[model samples]
Target chain A: MIAKPLALSLLLGALAVVPAAAQVKIGVVTSSSGPIALVGIPQKNSVALLPKSAGGQSIEYIALDDASDPTATVTAFKKLISEEKVDAIIGPSGTPNAMGVINFAAESGTPMLAPVGSAAIILPMTEPKKWVFKTTQNDGLVADKLIEHMVKTGIKTVGFIGTADPYGDNWLKVFTEGATAKGIKVVTAERFQRQDTSLTAQGLKVTASRPDAVLIAAPGSSSVLPETTLFDQGYRGKIYQTHGAALPDFLKLGGKKVEGTILAASLMLVLDDIPDTNVSKKLAVDYVAAYEKAYGTKPATFGANVYDAGLMLQSVIPVALKTAKPGTPEFRAALRTALEGVKELAGTQGVYNLSPEDHSGFDQRGLELITVSGGQWKLLK
Target chain B: MNMQIVMLLGQDGVTNGAVYALLALSIMLVFSVTRILLIPQGEFVAFAALTMAAMQSGRAVQLGWLVFALAVVATLMDAAKVWRSKGREPWPHGTLGLLAVAALALVLTKVLPLDRIGMFAQALLTIALVVPLGPLLYRVFFQAIAAAHSLVLLIVSIAVHVALVGTGLLMFGPEGGKTEPFSDAFFEIGPAMIASQTLWVIAATLALMGGLWVFFGKTLYGRALQATAVNRLGAELVGISPDLAGRASFTLAAAIGVLSGILIAPITTIYYDSGFIISLKGFVGAIIGGLTSFPVAALGALFIGQAEAFSTFWASSYKEVIVFTLLLPVLVWRSLAHTRVEDEE
Candidate 1:
């Protein structure tokens, strides 16, 4: 009688463990409290709004804060992969943070969805980079659009000022290539530290070059400094900023100086102007409304990048679920394959059309031309 | 670059150089008196600027609460120290003063229309809110370890800087801030148009430097502090409290830092983490003095500012590289010139 009861109890225990074992686990690492907190805080806040249940499986997110340090990012990635056994990972917010962990994610066969700015994380598309995918638009995509606008406006010569970091470095590389191809002469390129107290010398140099337009490529509010300095120095032709200047702080800090600035960024910046027929419009609206309700403020485009990462994972999890159980190595590998196979999937930022070669699968629909007029972002006519 | 560019860059250099000179003097003051490297000197500048920015935007300044909280912690620490020693030593000297200042700031923030107030009042209020932090921090972090070795003090100083930076992030969000310019008028001088704010920075820096010169030369407390810096044990035997000297120097440093912040906030954006690099530049200035002479340090900082400005014009990408590379030769020259070995302990 005792043996029979033991066998029955063991069967019940096995039944209890099966469902718990099948739950999908995802790891999220963000620089939620440090230098990059402007980007990381929104991404961290959006983590709560990510779908808890996706593709008939309950998804569990394990979040970590890297404090904007790259070494801490690697540690977080290792802990998540080794201890939590997370099937997929998202974020490690800044570009350098994400770039440091691509090898670890690949070695563990876990897919990483990085919501960072630099395209260097995915470009040169090495074997290890295959496990990593970017949710933000590529620098080249945004640069191409800005360069086209410059051409349309008959801007022949351009001056560039960017921060001396990877974000600026990549923008300079991409903008120079595109401008050169379009036969626009690049007159001067100056760089400044994000924490620089003054940009007077750079502003004077760029103004002296007398380019038809000046392009600035610093992220967040630091982008405002160069533009304002140029304004103060009487550079009047035109100013073109990169998508890095999409934050609301850009307007608040730049004030009257940035009144006529133009840039191309995600549709989220000009959501009201976007037609309802656009693929990403409805989702972006819903996200903005939900985010505003939750946080009492409109979410920046950086937040949408992470939310899009969630959407991508939500769309791909079911396909991955069919091949293997959630806790095994096969499941993580299958998830990576499924994410690559995602096509025509709409996210809050843009529609994803992932392939083997392109991990950041955004096209023209991902960006909209925006200009700052009278202290607000307006869709460019 | 032509004469016009030179004038423009020179103006920029002098404006920034003046701020760095103030910071260098304060760093030198605090280091000589306390044997502690003031790594967090720039945090005061950042906090004061952010506080000023918050006021300008009509937001209630939150720095008052931080001041109040730090003051309370400092008081508790002081009380604990007294209880442990079981002596009738006087209770913490500035706790009451700090608390009063904090409370006054909090009340003013709640009652006043911060944005409508003139820039002068906003600056004064920002200074009031931030200056007390200097003494409170000295009490809480450094007072107990005042007699520790210089290396230990340096390590502890770094730890405090890290903590304050994290606290800064919590207190002020990660966004950068710029305040309204002191004045909008421009001064045209020979090929260059100088912003009135630049003139204000230079003027304030000179005035403060002169004021410091008088204080150190005329005041009894200042002479006592100087004596302590010259010989700690001698000053102690002469009844000049080392602790008092430390707190006093920190207060002066904090005041200088906040003034620098107010002056420069209109010129550039400052983030919660911006202080380290700014103060590091000042530290570089301090090093150029071999961490000793005040006038040499001030001159060194001005030279650094000019080098930084000209380098930004010539090779923008390598501006920082060029500026920092200057320190190598200064260090080598100082080491080669001064062969006398003094015991650190």
Candidate 2:
């Protein structure tokens, strides 16, 4: 009986060792099919454009559709970790969806590189998010840029109209914090659902406050309702949108109404128009050429963020691969360490300088205040 | 808030309510005529709005092509049934009408310079492409299952809703589209200003309601639909085709939904998934009317619109909660006042 048990243990050990040279797998969870697919489709496309091989090992990217739901994201993350045994995970684009899997990522000791722009994803560097990293610039940084512009323009009071979800909540919190820090009084704050077709009531309240400026924090084209309502209501106050308005669809949807509105956006959005020596210029130009060449359209900022994540992963994987082979508990740990050690890597969105204390290795340098002028994005002077 | 603010909010509420009333009226019509809830009503709205967006961009819309293809399949089905059951000419008159409409839409899509055409004409073309989808969908998906139990039909409607949503996503892509307003004019009424689009929505809703009244009371076909709704077996005994009535109800529902989409798309961005939430709100209004009376449903939807407008001012985060919770008291009152009756097959 002892001899038979020893032979079974040896057989199991040999089986585990046989696939030591297997391809490195990266798990990706994106909202590829739901309402948030506005951002997720581009994210998936960017990941596909990444190099098929990394660190001399063939890479197998397993992409899952999360439908922009937190539960779906968690399930996809679990499947990636337990079933596929991926070396690292790439994304789940929306803030809430990305938030759903950070704790699981930490507990599993697997590295997660989220391409979403919410600071809370890696804020305070909590224990549960020790293994989590994000490639996108923090919302707080963009909020600061917005505040700086407001102060420079001598706008003292601002009103807020935000969505009712996590994206809205995150922006409201950060923008409020940033505004308060700069002594700008937020006169009134209003909320509406993303699917809401009417914002007359909210717009009325915001206009009633008579603030110097109104900040609309809703994401994507949904921002049009509140903005258009305010415009129709004859509110002449300066209007500002969040970085979420960086999409060209916003311009198309907003038409003339969004013209003259200001927002802090990733420099990648106006890469070609920016000064030649800008930090993000070179990387943004390269990304635009590669992406537009492949997909026949310029990638939105959401896709640029994901491309930054891909570059960050490429920069760190070679270092991780030097220590441990792929598809092992030890390899995942090394990858996490390697991701944390990624420093001064220029990306399409920013120069990533990942440290133990800051998983999102980006700062205010990556953002620029851009306005819609003459039906196109022009960097605000 | 001052009276001016109240008046402004009220104008906005009325505009939004008008659109909701249209959706609610259609939902009530379909439910009364056919027991199955029309879950995919919102999908029609989104599809219609997006089709208009495509036309505005001068791209030939695939919606016309889809309608043509669907009409072909529905005609084939109708012909097969007529051939086997009636032993007559297999050509369906209804199919002929649908095919003509489809052919007209396709021809216009090809020949018309959409950019050169006015916005009103583009909107008309969009509605034309969209309205026929209602009967065609009813014929293809629900006609055969018309006699199924309400629960089974409900399940099938939900499945159809999911399929349409997926199809919408594929056809429209992930981006949201908004069309230019039918009218960009604005006028002041007292201290409040009203957009011409709001006036357009109100005018369209009232006109549609009046038309529906005339159709139900004045037209023989409309009376047939009403009779079928009142007593399916009795109407059948009187030679009113229950199948035709069912198809008519669905077509009206689809038309109403698409009209609402056209009216509201300029006011708010219309995404593929937006229709579900907007239509669900309409369903809520329909429920408040006990899903029976058209006038009451319209009133309920207007009340919902006003309530939403007011609630956003008071507590924006909980506005949806406040609107939905209004159902509880209305439902309790309904239960207390009305006697329960079992549904008849």
- Assess every candidate by TM-score: 0.95, 0.93
**Clashes found in each candidate (C-alpha, N, C closer than 3 A):** 0, 0
User: Which docking class does model 1 fall in?
Assistant: acceptable
True contacts kept of 2: 0.56
lDDT of 1 by residue, B186-254 (tens): 989998898999889888999999999998889999899889889999999999988889999999999
The best candidate in terms of TM-score:
1
State the weakest 10-residue window (summed lDDT) of model 2 chain A: A9-18
Cα lDDT of candidate 2 equals 0.83
Per-residue lDDT over A219-296 for candidate 1, one digit per residue giving the tens place of the 0 to 100 score: 888999999999999888899999989988899899999998999998888888889999899999999899989987
**For model 2, what TM-score is found for chain B?**
0.94
Record all residue pairs in model 2 with backbone atoms less than 3 Å apart, i.e. clashing.
Answer: none
TM-score of 2: 0.93
